[model samples]
Target chain A: MNIKHSLLNIFQDNPTCWQLILDQALYGYLISQKNSPENFYINPALQEHLKLLLTDFKSEEFSFEIKEPLEKSEAKSIKTEAYFFLNGKKIASKKAHFLSFSFQQEEFYIAVFSSEKITRANAYQKTYDVGLAEKLKISEKAFQNNFEYGATGMALVSLEGKWLKVNKRISLMLGYTKEELFKLTFQDITVPEDLEKDLSLLKRLLDGEIDHYQLEKRYYHKNGSIVYAILAVSIVKNNDGLNLYFISQLIDITEMKRAEKRIKKLFKKSKEQNERLENFAHIVSHNLRSHAGNFSMLLELYESQLDEEDEIITMLSSASSNLQETIEHLSEIVNMHNSIKNTMESIAVLPVAKKTIENLSSQIQQHNLKITLAVDASLKVKAVPAYLESIFLNFISNAIKYSSPSKASFLEVNAEVEDAFIRIDFKDNGLGIDLEKHGHKLFKMYKTFHEHEDARGIGLFLTKNQIQAMGGKIEVESAVDEGTTFSIYLKKTT
Target chain B: MSTLKLTCIIDDDPIYVFGIQKVMDVINFCESTLIFKNGRDALDNLSSIIENNENIPDVILLDLNMPIMDGWEFLDEFIKIPSPKKVYIYVISSSIDPKDVNRVKRYQDVKNYIIKPVGPEQLSTILKDFKEDNFS
Candidate 1:
């Protein structure tokens, strides 16, 4: 008959014998059958009872029925429930646990039994309960709202590089919705240049070589901007020793990257400005001083040459004039350098232009030049007051000085607001320059293009420097014998 | 009473050269004088003189700044020539910068650093030194 029928017969006919077999099984006694043998050693008193039962039931027909199929327990062992019977009568029920392991191609099953009536707790069962509680605590903590909503991004990725789950923070950090992100792989969002490194680290983890890895990598946001992050990844494995998914944590560092770029750019700009200042100082020390020293030596020589008094006097007078001119230029440059750190103020541009025109009224009247001003009286720019006046003065004086002798000269000044700058245009009908020939040196010190008595070649250079010191820029356009237009871009006062 | 046999003036400034020539006339500085507008001209002519086995000048008044081959470059090239007679070089420059003065000392052939408008007294002292050495 079936094992169940046989178990029922044993349980009914030999109830004491079934109890003795279960007692021995629970107390770590070996029960050998025709071809299979089982061993247990949980207790000693039950073993004596099982030994006596084994001798008495040796000739009796006995069988057992598994009431429940063997399945993996929470403690990582096979567990099942079974019933024993003799002469078609049920005698006992048992809960059996087996730890199946393999060594050298041989499979072994070590079983532990618990009787229905006896509530004996085994070490494996106790460990199983504690392990289950600890796992629940960890899962509960991980799924808490605080952890999911933290500032740092966290995600779970599959072994194939697809994102299985992502917290709200990671979704927001990448500028993608949760639903949209779930459809994409980690490789899709990673920057192409950083994907290779990430893949290699993942390979090591999948090969069971590393527990986790951390790296600084770039990710692409939904808007196609680069996002810098410190990425930490750890692999979670299943009981079969395979990767279930990856736990990834990313710390955003985009702001820090932008700040570093800004600092580097600022450092380079300041270095260039310092180099220019040093070159200017060298010119002042050598070029200007050499001319002055020559004058002093010539004057002393003239004292001994009494016969050629008039000729020597003329030479000395010319030398002194040149020296005086050089000194004035040097002083102007020094003044501009000193005022570089001057605080800016909102000054009306029209009034400054008017004042500069008034200062040059005599020259204008002498030349019979016509002047037109179209700037608004309320137009103001952020600049040093002294620099504003000086800039206007230089532009107006230059227009008058370079007036064309062929025709009566006219000056037109106007201002317009453009974006963040107030663009002031000074158009003069004068002897315009051939920009192709002199454009490069137009704002350089001591570079004279036109042969004019008043062209010291220092006005435009100083004006350019002054404008730059006030956070402004100057541009010029000219053609030979036509006219010149100077455009000054000044930062507008808010 | 002129102890100097020959003197050379290598300068680009005509006015300063004229002044020095007038002063030399008053002092009876040398029997003959040679002039070059720049250091390159002086170097080329002097090199040719050496090649031709001609008599070289006893003294050279060199100006530092010129159109081509400045005094420093001329000195650098001149020292390599194998000369039979010792030629003393005086660097006359309008630069009062101490760096220039120190640089002049680097050239062993350069005997003195004179500022512009070299007075008769300075020339007389240089002549006195030359006469004393010649006698000794």
Candidate 2:
């Protein structure tokens, strides 16, 4: 036998005197001499060293002190016994124990201890048990790998939330390198808004209030962008009811948040669309029935007055004209409803207003109605051009139609920017309405609230439909004999 | 129905009033047909007739949407009166809203809702349903 200095071949390749000396020293301090592997592996180099070392001393080396009895069945997830190592060495001597478990056949007992117990095991066995160490090491690595790449951002923290170890994926998610993150603590990167929540949960975990908890939390990245994540944290407990560290898994949901916002907007628009369609059906049914009823009435009149030759011609003509007007009104309502369903075009408010005024210039001059238009150049509205023109022309004509003959007609059209919208207020000082009572019925079809001979009450109703189709709104404010002001709100296009 | 002494036209429009009255005279719908401009005047006249113990009209032509008071309001007040007999009242309007027709159907006193302008044929058809055979 020869003496060896290298630790690589200490157990199998070469059994040196120094290695044997250290091994006997460790074994003697742990298990004295019950039934140990040391008794069987006593050979030339180690035996020479063991015998030489004991040549001067004279005492039994070790004995097994059992802290707890072993159970044959429950050898997993729990330890059955604690084997303490007592030594008189250069460092401070303390009782270091290992949690023990029996082997598969109960013929052997396999013990689990920390890497801190590496030096103490040399006496118990000359071989390092490389096969088992490699297997255990590989399994730990695999477990860490699976968690690292998952959607969850994982981390290992000391009991107090110090970042002991973190994966590359987690570092990427927080916008930091792994080396930089390992230096900082988990609490350091956590957003201030999420700090209180995390700490409170940690307190509960420390007090054994809960084993696990989940939260939708935010963390600050190295680049200062907020990282939104759904965090799931679990506590790793030590043997004596002490926390080892925390394991946190984070699922980032920033894209999900954006998608939720988009869906909510779509839902609101669809709900509004659903309501508008419901109203459209009712309006369509109402218009169709009125025309049908009027036609039937005209026919009834023509039939009954057929015997009266003197008044037959005139009555028939009147009945026919009324029927034709009813049909035309129905067609117009249906056509307007259909047009809005196709598409909405984008147009500038100022140009549209100018064009509308120019087209109705003759009528404006005919009524001698003074029109004051103050539209901002910055305002752009999305709407069908003709529909917009028609909406404006209808209001303008109505301003002239229902104007007070006694006073000078004054129609002021002015627009201003509102919140995400442009509001054009058409204020007239001619004739007003008793809106306190007839306000609700103003938009209803064929609802004649005024004595104006031309007031079929259809113009304002159609105007409302057109505006709504083009993503706009119109509201009226009126007084009986004072005046009327119609405010039209249109969404501003970028 | 019992023999009608007076038939009343309660509408705001004169043209519609004249047309219906002429149709009624041609069919001889009722004797001594009276006309009221609004429901207020009709209710006032009816209240006076009740005070005087005069007979209510055998057939009443009521317009639903009108100035001062409407057909629905007239029915509300007319039902409050302890009438000596059942009076057949018909609602006549140019409004073809189903809600209006359905609403008038709720009132038991309203015999029918006539779509306007009120023609002599519909009046004749309604008169055929009356118990009195004066027209025949």
Candidate 3:
């Protein structure tokens, strides 16, 4: 029985037995003081029983005896019993390990001291039985929060393509919630076109032939839209001797895909244009060359037969003039071909813009055009200086010539830094071409839209070719009546 | 039949063909000469000759540029023939393009690249390489 239980059992007796118990308790106390040694040594078993009875008496009012060093007598007394203290008093000095015995078998009273230290209750900690639960609770809360939310489309897959775990980013990228994502396998979501290659790469990874695999592949979104992604799958072994998992860092590259598609179309167009140019080169080399050779032959015949030439001197003169004109045309074409500017010289934008303005000073003042330049002054671009001047002069002259005579012409040239590219926008308030109808042939040679007699269509063609050769591109946005805006994207070399 | 019965001339330019003929006459070269404007016309005649098992052109003077099919294109198509026949192709042009000259030399069947304005000396050299007499 515990101490409280033994004490309670002693005090909870009936009134008829209360006085007897109290008297016995008093006798035990007095007898203990009188002959402490004799009391213990008289009956060896009875001394222990008497000590238990005295120890059972509840009250902290007893005077404790200072027993001297057990010099033979005290030591002999202890042979029959043990010594115990209660409430700073030697209440029981006996050998009894048992304190109280009840009439009912299950009601024995004994002292029970709880050895568990008291601390505040942690999460769901009802009893002191479980240790370090409070510390574990604090650490677990921190650990649970450590599994951060955004992780750039993370997917934890088994080596066999089973979806083990996935983060919120992957779920969002795949257009599925976490609950829905766990139910699907990677093979199910992978594009059929990329499945075989990805699986082969994954097999190589599992065999340790490769550390990881990164590829731009497509995944089926939950909404049936194709999501282009840069997928990097890394193999990770579990700390527990479980299966290896693949951590896929999928970056949604749908924008990159769109850009790629645009670039592919642009490349196809340029390739077709190059093929056309090759055909044109062949035509010029054949037909024009034959004409030139024929014109020279006619001269040779005239020189050989001067008497026949006197009769056809006017015809010969006209032929010679026509030949000269043809030669001039050929020379023009050759000059245009040779003037394909492709120098990668990095020059400050400020100086070039200032020179272009100065070169077009008369036209700018003549047309009374309001010009604004918001280019980054310290910005340097890699391009041929002559080509830049030609492009600027052509654009500025066109703006001056084609602008509305009613209102003052406005021109704006500005540059903004984009990732890996410098985008320069040249805006002009001028007679814009109908792009919806004629945009395809805007950069084609001999294609003209304006009624201006001097608008030779070669300027835009040469400009486009020059820009393309310098690793830049030009895109024009215009309406027939509104205005024209050229968005030129040039790669930043340095 | 022992001598060259028919020497063929294949060129789009009539003036160049006339000039070659005059040079050939000056050098007292082959009398029977055939003319073709482009590779397509020449290949057509050659293919017919091949089908009939007749005498094909001993020497083909090809130009790089033409209306239908150019010289290089015709050469690529012509080499696919299964028949075991000996033929020499010569590229004649005024094009000073070094790339074209180097490319023509890479063809195993091409004998030489001759620049235009053919003269008696050029014809004599070809006749000498053929190991034939000056006049046939």
Candidate 4:
């Protein structure tokens, strides 16, 4: 009916043309009786092609099956693209034409088999492969640039500890060239004392015990100097979980380490000098106070024995009292230095402030200052009891002593719990300090702001030392002739 | 309360000892007084007094810092002795150190800690407290 069926019948009827068709290069030919599907002949060229594509290709075991039914009178042909299997194992896919016809009297079948030809889809696949190769080349160039120009030293090491690749920074850090570094393993450049630790960590990484490791290690520079670096290392693995290479990055810290050593040496020297100074001050204060005490006692005894006040005795008595006062102040400072050894305890702030205010009640009443204590009853601070009491005494007394005579003065003592500290504010509307001129020297010894008769200038200095010894700090806010606010931050007790 | 029969002073400073003794006489602090230059002299004399079963002083004014033995060492040895009388010990020192003051409170025999230049007022308070303890 069709030209294709007519040509197929003509080819099937002529046995001479069958040989010509079997000799074709574009297709492989196979002939079989219609009833014997297992017995067939495979052309030599296709058998050679099968031997290349399959695990084992045997001509004797080759078989064919025509899934479409054949009519009884006219010739029927079927074309199919199917997979060929030998002994249940897939070999290859082939396009085949099966022509069922009567050659003489019995029915016979001729099959034409061909490998898949190169179509437009295959051509596109070929171009896609070329594009993938070009992209891979560009990415490899980018990787090379990163490895070569990175800031820190980088290296790729083999599993056997051999240096596989090294960047320029690694070469410079080790005082070796890139070519020279590759000839040696990382162990060769590492300091012997640090080798064992590095090797053990690397072993752990290789054993899958740790994903990565970082350590401060030492390496020997080419010039025999010790180089300090912070080394971070991780392993690269293949899809099959095989050890590929180690990626190591090293940051130089030799300068930092040298500076740290210098700082420590200086700190030790300063601490020793400070201890000696403290001891000297302690001895001086102790001896001076003892002599001053005896001098005052003798002066008092002399004055008591005399019926009338002697001018010389009175002058000596005043001098002795001044001497005693100076020595007392000196001893107080020396004692403040020793207060660090005192034990700290949590004491309620309100009770201590209340007691201090009560002790200075006469002075407060004399000054006619309204002293309002706004400290919470529940708030507590961590401090040495004596230091805390002295702190409160110095601030409250100073407030009373500096109260303004022109106006009704008010001193507000407020305590609030802040972050990790108890902030106590001693704010007084009194004769405020000229902080612009005296701010820098406000807390220095013997630096008095006002000409008040009782302003010794030692109170603030002593108070600051005591506060600091208890791990606290003091801040002052003042304005001339207006007011002064002293805020002390003490450790809050949970 | 009646006056104490006897009082003892143990100090290293002669000036301080002289001043205290004069003040005691002026205040009519006790009927009699015994003095030692340091804690060692007082400890030895007190140990002898205890051995003889004589009248131990009613009050002991102990100074902390001394040449041979300090007041702390004297108290350590005196408390070990089994005495016939209950003597009240008071630590009087020039040291205004809180540590020294707090250390004195640890001794049961120590009645109080007094800072020096004790003058008349502190001595009067001590005498009154002693009379109170005796008569109350």
Note the clash tally of each candidate: 20, 7, 11, 0
- Write the residue-wise lDDT of candidate 1 on B26-69 in tens digits: 78888888999998999999999987879789899999888878
Candidate 4 clashing pairs, residues 3+ apart or interchain: none
Q: On residues B1-136, what C-alpha lDDT tens digit does candidate 3 reach at each position? A: 2234457676788877776665565556775677888888988888888778787666677878766877888889777775556665678765534456778988998878875545556666676766643344
Candidate 2, residues B8-37, lDDT tens digits: the string is 778876767766766677777887777888
Q: Quality of candidate 1's docking, in CAPRI categories?
A: incorrect
| Displacement of the residue A147 alpha carbon in candidate 4, Å | 3.7
TM-score of 2: 0.41
Which candidate has the highest TM-score of all?
A: 4
Q: Which digits, one per residue and each the tens of the lDDT, describe model 1 over residues A203-231?
A: 99999999999999999999999999999
* Reference contact recovery of candidate 1: 0.21
Q: Report the candidate with higher lDDT, 1 versus 3.
A: 1
Query: A1-494 in candidate 2: lDDT tens per residue?
Result: 45456554665556575556655443322322223423222223223323332223222342234455435444453433433221332211223333333443433333332233333445224323443464567777988778667656788888767777777678878888878887888789888888899889889987899999988888888888888889888988777887888988877887897788899999999999988975765554444444445454545555666765546566666676666566556645655555554456666888877887898889888888899989887788777777788888888888888788887888998988898778888888767888888898888888877788888877888788778866779898998767899998887786
Ranked candidates, highest TM-score first: 4, 1, 2, 3
Q: Model 2, stretches more than 4 Å misplaced?
A: A1-136, A157-207, A216-228, A287-494, B1-81, B91-107, B113-118, B131-136
- TM-score of each predicted structure versus truth: 0.47, 0.41, 0.38, 0.61
Cα error of candidate 4 at position A345, Å:
8.2
**Between the candidate structures 2 and 4, which one is better when assessed by DockQ?**
4
lDDT values, one for every candidate: 0.77, 0.69, 0.66, 0.83
lDDT of 4 at A450: 79
DockQ of 1: 0.11
